[model samples]
Target: MSDNQNLLAGQRRALILDEVRRRGGVRVSELTRMLRVSDMTVRRDLDALARQGMLEKVHGGAVPVPEGRTHEPGFEAKSALETSAKYAIARAAAGFAAPGGAVALSGGTTTYAVAQQLVEVAELTVVTNSVRVADVFHTAPRPAEGGPARPATVVLTGGVRTPSDALVGPVADAAIAALHFDVLFLGVHGLSEGAGLSTPNLAEAETNRHFIRSARRVVLVADHTKWGVTGLSSFAALEQVDVLVTDSGLEPEARRVLAERVPELIIADAEEE
Candidate 1:
């Protein structure tokens, strides 16, 4: 009877988790009715799931935990945020990619934006750690109407993938160490005077360090929203940043401080239509 109870409890919690993920949130009372369990039992299940990091318990019930310093969000979730700002930042950063020069692009929505524009650069070589970014080049349209076909050569690193779709770990770090680039376009989960550049994934931070060392110039591409948000791991310091490209939403104080620390700061117009 005890074993059966344990199995039933496990199945109930699984159902509760599925409901929370699907509906975005769930009420304890509703869950009790749906599962035909007591309110206290539903509460216990919610508490267990929360402790296991599967969901977050709120006032009435439970919801998904918002991505925090340690909680990394998936690519789809992040890509939907700061759309115009990322595009603007990417446009400004892509200008630094010289034709015929080697460029390294770190994984993030903003860097993925940069990859889209780089497809037009003639004879460029791009090294990247994001499979999604690599796919941008891999699926780029062929030269139009028999025009000169000069697609940039893309080198993708191999490693374990993070929730944000970044390839990290020793394999990625080692791959980046073996090569060098003229410039590196890095996108971060957060940037600040203290944290500098950071990501929630520790392996990605280490891999990003390798990228910074392998490039002559490091241009950090991020939107204004990332200014003060610190992540679990930091990769580079402010003094190491050669340039920063961001949108107009950045505060004046942030701009002043960043301009003082970074060599150059470029603000792009991010007005959406």
Candidate 2:
């Protein structure tokens, strides 16, 4: 390839990955317009990346590979969602956790909220795969009359890093497998009748499955918006999850579906209080 062609290819490849990260998936038609490249050229670029296992090609677009890693979302965009609901869900989920209990928190914004609420609780050991989640407790202050400090031990899993800052892979899986937690709080991209618990990245799904296997109970913490969207990988079936904690704004139909599928559903109304 000529120097200009090489530069173009590099740029296009970067754009493709960025788009996939941003949208969770992207179609060929969208890329062609965004990158101003011929459909054939875009296909070639996607093919090259797909061969490397960075992405999975679908009919018209590509989805991220399920690995411990993920595409990053803008901080502002992620923070804009049902904030009140997330806080309520966090409080309710945190109530289920006991002091001195061993817990594993999966990566995601909802899980991050859970970590924040956990700071007030004393003598808890938290194992997590999210760099962001670990950081929250790492800087938390100790309680004034504490027998032991608040937010006891925080363990961060080691593995390959994804764009979304998740640590996922064989290393992560092995680490999770070695410990049995009292509860595991998982964050998901989407929940559907057919897909069950799903995420955009296949690698993340694999690592999540390992977490589920290692935990005695599994609680899925997600917002109402995640109810209908379908991602690329299914991490757990509804029956496998012990509890589904979500906001009160959840659609009635979605609640009915979840109640039918999941064993228990906890609806936290942040607005009530």
For all candidates in order, the CA lDDT equals: 0.87, 0.82
lDDT of 1 at 196: 86
* Candidate closest to the true structure, highest TM-score: 1
Off by over 4 Å in 2: 1-76, 145-148
For residues 162-256, write the lDDT of model 2, one tens digit per residue.
64567899999999989999999898887888888887778889999999999999999998978877778888888888999999879999999
Q: Each prediction's TM-score against the native?
A: 0.76, 0.72
For candidate 1, lDDT tens digit of each residue in 3-83? 323447766776777688669999999987788768999999888777766789999999977767887877765665667
Per lDDT, the best of the predicted structures is 1
